[model samples]
Target: MRRHRRAKIVATVGPASAAPDKLRALFLAGVDTFRLNFSHGLQEDHARVHAAIRALEQEVGRPIGILQDLQGPKIRIGTVKDGRLDLTAGETVRFVLDGSEGDKQAIPLCHPEIFAAAAPGQDLLIDDGRIRVRVVGLDADTLTAEVITGGPVSNRKGVNLPGTLLDLSPLTPKDRADLAFGLELGVDWVALSFVQKPSDVVEARALIGNRAGILSKIEKPQALERIGDIIRLSDAVMVARGDLGVEIPHEDVPGRQKELIRACRLAAKPVVVATQMLDSMVAAPAPTRAEASDVATAIYDGADAVMLSAESATGQYPVEAVTMMDRIIRSVEGHKLYRSIIATSDPGEEETPPHAVASATATLAEAVQASAIVTYTTSGTTTARVARKRPAVPILALTPHLATARRLCLMWGAHSVHTDDVDSYEEMTTKAADCAVQEEFARSSDLIVTTAGIPFQMAGNTNNIRVIQIQ
Candidate 1:
């Protein structure tokens, strides 16, 4: 369904709200996209949510996007000997990866690769950094560590290496299976978690094969380092603040979040601000003023979407959370500064390739009074770049990736269409104009802004810009 506010709301579906009726209420409450966290629900449960979303789309007479978030490689300690281990500060604990039978003295570290790359003095955060430990010694099968902080560590507690580069891929075996299933279900978007580099995006895209758009979750510090490359590769970007906050300095997260949104906006990629927006709403009907301000800031920053995690998935007030988020977005969007904040960006020192193309498209769109701007993007980079310009017309993004289309749902003034890639710029523009007219998205008399590369090469190869009349 078409959202009234420029920024969109993305609600997670979980046990608290998965039924068709409940989902319909969420949609009515103003959820533009539905996020199915593969980390929690079963495939059958996801199928039900998918069906409900499709049904609701029909009922509402508008396309609703579905994002299937893959549970990426999550390294965790195996079952504890007594189901829980309490470590007192200054106590030494050993993390072993030996195939030896489970014992109370040493816990089985599922990821030995972590030890190979880890160094002494590196901090290891367990269970969301609840239990802090420092690497003391390294061995083939065991990592000796002294507990720096005392806490109860339970079964399958997650392990986080903040700065250390673990010798492990982002995708796990389970993620591959989930990706296959998501493709079979024809999901609109697939979110890859814990993305450390641009190569991760390429590998996932190769597997997805244009089935769905890829939204790389920028959570780890490594990801922040390679953001420009990742943005060039990924279809969209998600500021996953949960793990991000855990990985980086908490205070730095706010500035990083704004930076990411601006980067995506400059690239015209849809950026979603996710995690803990209404955390208190998980149990309370009302959100704290801080939470409201957090959401308003995202909207004010011109983020394409603000996401809810536990607030809607397992929260006591799922509907209310969505309602509140919707109200906050609407309120923030009403402010004249909202559009200005979204439009205002650091002026480019020079016209880069994508920036030059985007500036040209915006100028042409205004000059020709175009009804729409049609962007053909392979990795959705060119599309995002154009969107950053925030032209005074609808942007029709045509991509071969479904995930890109779904992700674009959150972008300002963007309407995504799934289409096969064109081999030539001429074909791409003509087809875009034809689709715009055929779908009644634009009229034959309407001028259309078109941008693409001459040869339709790699991602970020946006060099062409034109204004054409729809026929």
Candidate 2:
């Protein structure tokens, strides 16, 4: 199906929307990708959902993307006295590397990485920053801190060390197992969480090995410090604002989101703005105005996709949430100021032949008011480059590889079609025009722009651009 909006929607599948009929409804409501969160549900649950999605894909005759989001290392305090502890602002709390339950005087924090990496004056936020503490002293096995913001600390509350970089892998043992299961299920995208450095992405890439697209979730402050390297290494990026807001100043998130989006655009990689796009929709039928504005802002910033977490996973109105997001994107893109805003924020083309050709194709298509920009892509690179320009016309990406078509579902403005590989220029032109007509992207006598590499079926060699008029 051809989406009216350029930006895509990613919906998480859970108990609320796990049935085949619900999945199909979500897809029809404009969900381009489905996210399977390993943080919850069993492997068998995900397998069933995966099977249903594949069936839906065949039924609709469209490529649908599936993203497996790994639950990375989670550091949390051990059991507390009476299941909770009430702390005062000036009270001193002692945290020890023990598994035994204790009172406020000696709270057990089982994670050793936090104790080893934490230093005096570094802040420790618990329960999503509801209770804050700053370390004042530390020993080999214990960390003493005074409460900066006092609150009721409960058992197993999550810990966030914004100022310290723990020597830990983003992929936990469970994540590795989950990754294996997802790869076996043939997922199109793998979202690596808790990415603190570039090495985290490298480690994931080693296991992924081109089987799936590696998307790094930028939710840690340390990741932002080395974002350039992280973005360069990963196939795509996600502005994970939920945990990110807890780690950094809430005011800094919008600027960081824009920076990450621009960086991904420069690299011609897909970027998703995730976490609570329509949070209130989890309970309410419609989203709050602020939530709608939030989704529009991401689209205006040129985000490739906006995602729904709990809003679609366990929400009361999962299909309505996707429909609302789709409507918001269409409205924002149709606004008179959108084109100018996107043009102003353009990262421009890189100094490469492929990039030059892609940029020229976009420019020429707009100059001629072409009906569509048809791209003959083997590795989806040529289509991605054209999408990065955010052209006015639609983009029809024809590729022989179904994986390429599925991966391109997350890219902005690219409607992917899995077609047979063309061997010559004549075949390429004929196939592009035929697919455009078949896909309802063009009609007889309509002008269209086509781009491809000279060597057929070779990846990343976009050195040719052609303008054709359908007969």
Candidate 3:
């Protein structure tokens, strides 16, 4: 289907939208990619969803993207006495490193990594920061902390230690297994959660290789410290704002979001703004005004895509949420100030032949008011570069590789078509014109800008651009 807007929508699959018919409805409603969250479901459940998506792709005659989200290390307090404990503000509490049940005196914290990394004076946020505590003292067996914010500390509530860098790999044994399964299932993208350093991405890259794109989730405070290196190492990035908000100050999230989007644009990598974009849609048919503004803000900042988590997963209005997100993007892109705003934030091209050609292609397309900017790609580099420019016209990416086409679905303004390889200049232009017409990108006599490599099918060799008028 042709999307009037440039930004894409990624929807998570869950019980609310896991049926084949529901999946098809979501695709028709404007979902560009499907994210399978491994944190909540069984392996069999995810496998079923993956199979259904592939089946839907075949039926629609379009390349659909599948993203496997690995559940990283989960740190939480062990079971509490009577399943709950309340610590009032300013009260002293002790967290012991044992698996036994706990009371107001000694709560069980089973993870030793937190103890090893944590120290006096650092704040410990529990249960999504509802219950805050400041570390007063620590020993090999226990951490003595004073409750900063009083609240009930439930059994196994998640623990967040802001500013403390734990010596742990983002990947757990479960994540490794999930990664292997996703790779075997032919997912287009793998999103690694809890990424703290560049080495975390490197470790995932070692396992992923060229099988799928590695998308780092920038939800850790440590990740923000080395974002540039992390972005350089990752194929793509996601602003997972849920856990991110808990780990960092909420006021700083917006600035960090803008910074990430700009960095990804400058690097020509896709970035997805996720979490609670339409959160209220989980129960209500329409989202709150602030939530609508949140989605629009990301589009205005030039995010490649905005994602739906519980809104599309277990929400009551999955299709409605997708439709609303689609409308929000179209509205933002059609705003009078959109063009100027995007251009203002545009990162100028790098000093290289490919970058120069890509930048020129966008400039030339706008200058000539072309119908579309068509790119021939094998590994999607040329298309990504063209998209980074955020050209006025839509990007029609023609690729012979289905994997490449599927992966490009996550990029901004990129409409990927799986076509046969073109061998020569004559054939390339002919195919470009044909696909443009068949895909309804342009009508007869309309002009289009086409880009490709000289060696024909070689990857990462973007060296040519031509403006062709449909016959």
Say which prediction, candidate 1 or candidate 3, comes out ahead on TM-score.
3
Cα distance off (Å), candidate 3, residue 64: 0.7
How far is 392's C-alpha from truth in model 1 (Å)?
5.9
Error (Å) of candidate 2 at residue 452 is 0.7
Which lDDT values do the candidates have, in the order given?
Answer: 0.82, 0.94, 0.94
Alpha-carbon lDDT of model 3: 0.94
lDDT of 1 by residue, 1-471 (tens): 345555778899999889999999999998888999999878988998998888887787556789999988887888877688888998888888853334435777878778788889898999988888999898777888888988898888899999866666778988998889888988888999999988999889889877778899998999999899999888789999999998898999999999998888766678899989999999999999999999999877768889998999999999999999999988887777765665676334235867787778876887878877888876666776776766656777788765566666766666767787677767787899887886566886788888876667577788888878766
TM-score of structure candidate 3: 0.98
Model 3 Cα lDDT, one tens digit per residue, 1-471: 888889999999999999999999999999999999999899899999999999999999999999999989978998888898989999999999985789877899888998898889999999989999999999888999999999888888999999778888989999999999999999999999999999999999999999999999999999999999999999899999989999888999999999999999999999999999999999999999999999999999999999999999999999999999999999999999999999999977688889888989999998999999999999999999999999889999999999999999899999999999878888999999999999999998899999988888788889999999999
Worst 10 residues of 3 by lDDT: 97-106
How does candidate 2 fare on TM-score?
A: 0.98
User: Where's the lowest-lDDT run of ten residues in candidate 2?
Assistant: 97-106
